[model samples]
Target: MFSVWKISLLFMASLALTAATIPGKKDRRPLGGWTDVNVTENDSGLQKALEVAIREHNKASNDQFINVVTNVIRARRQIVAGMKYSLNVQIAKTDCRKSDSTPENCTESELSRLSQHKRCRFVVYLVPWLKKEELKQNNCD
Candidate 1:
């Protein structure tokens, strides 16, 4: 006794529900674990590279910030897998200086006004750290 419209609506709703309930396939590698390494506050190239890497990684969201360091070097190959875009990154010669308080403790305005001089510099790579082999290959000591 259902009307054509009602049947169609029910079918569509069922389809939507089924799709929602089904979990997506898991990715072997996820980009959520990565971070950005900027030599300066306004370094567009580094930002673009990070953006490209994130896009290539197919991560769920791009609102998060990642700090690329030596620790991330182990996953370097995975990170750069589909990155077609380019950006200049350098090995951080020195450690990044810490602020008196954690990022959460800082005000939004203060965080927004952050500068690159406070971060490390080495300009060939944008990640925080590099593996020995990767470093050697990139000529980044």
Candidate 2:
């Protein structure tokens, strides 16, 4: 009986050790991991990220008119030194330019042979406390 009890205790100890080493559902959010954020969640933060992307896009674009996000397709986030936002969005060309009176209510270009709403993916890194955002990458089609 003493030997049997000793064996059961050893087995339990091994099981406990294995549990810690094995990855589980709870381990999904490990350090430096990216998390899929709902497009509707964190409205202000998402908006800021979108703005950064749009500003950068306009800066690099040769298109005559400015582009604006028409829809948010998806969003992801990673916690780095500050935070990183990954966005997949649909953008439409607008009639407003840099000197336009107001961008609001600007007509959007139609999705036709010559022009179409673009699907864009942008990755932005931001340090919130500093209120600064850098566009790490942008791709659109």
Candidate 3:
């Protein structure tokens, strides 16, 4: 048992050292699939994408309660024909039910059946010239 504990500690230390020595690995290219973008929660583009994503999700989801973004974890941008944003966000359930309400006026729901929190990854595509925003994907856990 002592030997196993010592070995585990040594292994963990080695893994930490290895990680610390490794350089951030990625070649930032123009067409790279998803590159981290410098964006804040206040960024209009990112905010728009989040709204569109949530709205689209609500439309497609079977859940009666609506969900809204609580925070943005990560946001990445990809260039193809248009700009595609891949965002990892924290979302929580709201008091509003999809059947008769909208998220704009809904508050967070903390009640038993309404309490739900999830990390969602949403891909939103934007075409500025055409003034369009579309959701490419919405996945949550």
Best by lDDT: 2
Highest TM-score scorer: 2
Candidate 1 on 45-118: residue-level lDDT in tens? 45444433433322222323322321222122224433222233322212222323332232323423232312
Against the correct fold, how does model 3 do in TM-score? Answer: 0.68
Candidate 2, residue 11: how far the Cα is off, in Å: 19
For residues 36-133, could you state the per-residue lDDT of candidate 2 as single tens digits?
A: 88787667777888888988888888876777888899998899998899999998876576566233444454323345688999999999899888
lDDT of 3: 0.80
**Candidate 3 lDDT, 63-118, residue by residue in tens:** 89888888788998888787889999988877677878886666554323646679
lDDT against the true structure, per candidate, is 0.35, 0.81, 0.80
Query: What's the count of clashing pairs in each model shown?
Result: 17, 0, 0
Residue 109, model 1: lDDT of 38
Ranking according to lDDT, highest score first: 2, 3, 1
RMSD of 3: 15.1
Span of ten consecutive residues with least summed lDDT in model 3: 107-116
Cα RMSDs, all models = 15.6, 5.8, 15.1
